[model samples]
Target chain A: MALPHAIMTALLEDDMSGYELAKAFDVSVGLFWRSSHQQIYQELHKLADRGWLQCATVAQAGKPDKILYTLTEEGRDAMAEWVLGESRVQEGKDDLYVKLYNLSEDNANHLTAEISRRREHMMQRLYLYEKIRRRHYANPVSLPVRRKGVFLALLAGIRQGEQFLAWCDEALAMLGTIDEPVE
Target chain B: MALPHAIMTALLEDDMSGYELAKAFDVSVGLFWRSSHQQIYQELHKLADRGWLQCATVAQAGKPDKILYTLTEEGRDAMAEWVLGESRVQEGKDDLYVKLYNLSEDNANHLTAEISRRREHMMQRLYLYEKIRRRHYANPVSLPVRRKGVFLALLAGIRQGEQFLAWCDEALAMLGTIDEPVE
Candidate 1:
């Protein structure tokens, strides 16, 4: 259900081959959602089989036929239904947080290490967002509303990254004096 | 691994029955981490079998024997190793962002609904944080460092929740006008 929704939504803009869809997802959808190339190809076939997507095969020089997918009217209805249907937030199931909880209860020293690792990880994400923003600026999409929303989302990600990094620093600093007698 | 870490960390504070561990997770650890009771029990058994945790059975009236779990030195060692290990940020993992991305691309109307759902969810989380904060103020823990850190985390959660809810309102307003072009 998730895969088809993504596929249909992508097709609404324009028809794209499986490879092309995967690449776009990497650049655009990849920011918010991710599906492997293998998974995308598999879903393409499924959508085509279900009549929600129509495929046009174009032969490339010395290469396999590339099937491009487009959304049908039925697919449009499906997307509309999905949007209006009973929506629910999938609870965040974070393993790292769970581990942190354990560390917090047991060992302060262990938590310090985890905080260090998590801070570094957040820094990496901040970097990735910068790259994505630069790419978006270079090749502007006509949908400015969508682009603006994405930029805001990117800001949120950066904010969150910084928060985690800052939290790590604070946690580490506190650790130094954690066992020492309070001043 | 995450589950085991959570269980061990809980034990680090003091040996706790599975039920108490779950409640502690919900009240305190839950500010940043989350886990289900079933998962906690399952991980406890696994950790004990692996010699990473020591368990003591406590008699209870009108209830099954409650097993109290405590982390072993080896478990602490493992937790230390994990905490100090390199942090890897798993990218493209957020479902809500992905959904928003697709919504922006497909239709503004759909994005509105998603934002609405997020606003409500954040408000609910805000309430939960408030309840926890009040309880923490009433009863205290041994480690002042941990107590302060937990409060800081709760504050962060509250701020983030407020920001998200506010963002949703702004987004909805923008969507409302964007869809209706100037006459």
Candidate 2:
């Protein structure tokens, strides 16, 4: 999907500078989609050039002038059309599984290493999810009063991370038994 | 990180062809890292050229010859070093989040439409995960008992998919509330 489509859609909700847009992405829709700062800047220019987004130069003290971006009428129409055309399946493109599938001959040690790496990685995610939950509980948003959805999504992230960790434990045990060859 | 590094690491575990690697990535590591078929193919060539990987040409009766890749000592060393390196935090680079971060000023109706689109997506994932689970339960692999680690990883995939689906439901509810704001 074009970055401009998502970018313009977000702008239709509120006006924001590029920096703020980047931050907001991390908190919300970021669960599925992502972009780099450079990519964001590029998309912003493309959207504005295409007349889908309007930019107003706002003066700031000390810092350079910020360009505040908002969606135009055309942009809204484009975003609406894109939303309606959205599909049901979001197929992820990932790499780790590819290595696992190409199992030529069994090497128990390599498999063990991979499992160990994944376990550590899941632990890190669990920690991060916990932090997000704590932040939410401590400073509840006055806006979005019905924020059960956000909470649920965060919980899902935490649970999924924990689930992987548990699986790692089971996998490690299974691997241990395999490593012990019968005489 | 470089695609070659990731691919080489996978080879260190076991040898695989380019096509097999592509499919495996979809099922396993797709949760964290992503790679394109083109990138994987390119990496194979590069690695072989550098003597890090050697390709054995296989003769097929009626099909094109396929090159099976195995790691060299240098490739194994590279992968070992990479595996021991400090793992970086998984950054939020999703395009969907970038879009949402810019949504505060958007038309509520449009945003709601997008949320609904995402909800349908989560349901689709739920269905796919269930199918995979059923397949495994129906015909369990005949490998030694110790081989359950592979299945454990598969189960992890199903759970992660379900978690995302649950989160989508919550997000939909929040979006619905915002669509009809209280005066």
lDDT of 1 by residue, A60-136 (tens): 99988898788889887876667555555544444445444333434566666666777777687778877877777
Across B94-158, the per-residue lDDT of candidate 1 in tens digits comes to 55554554444345666677777778777888898888777774443444555655555565566
Report the alpha-carbon TM-score of model 2 versus the true structure: 0.63
Error of 2 at A95 (Å): 6.8
TM agreement with the true structure for every prediction: 0.73, 0.63
Listed models, DockQ each:
0.31, 0.22
Runs off by more than 4 Å, candidate 2: A30-32, A88-183, B5-36, B91-152, B165-183
Model 2 over residues B84-141: C-alpha lDDT tens digits?
4444434433434333433342344555566667767657756765676576644434
lDDT of 2 at B124: 72
What would the per-residue lDDT of candidate 2 be over residues A65-175, giving only the tens digit for each residue? 989998899887776555434433444433333333332224445666777887787787677668877877444344453244345445556766776677677656656
Error of 1 at B154 (Å): 4.0
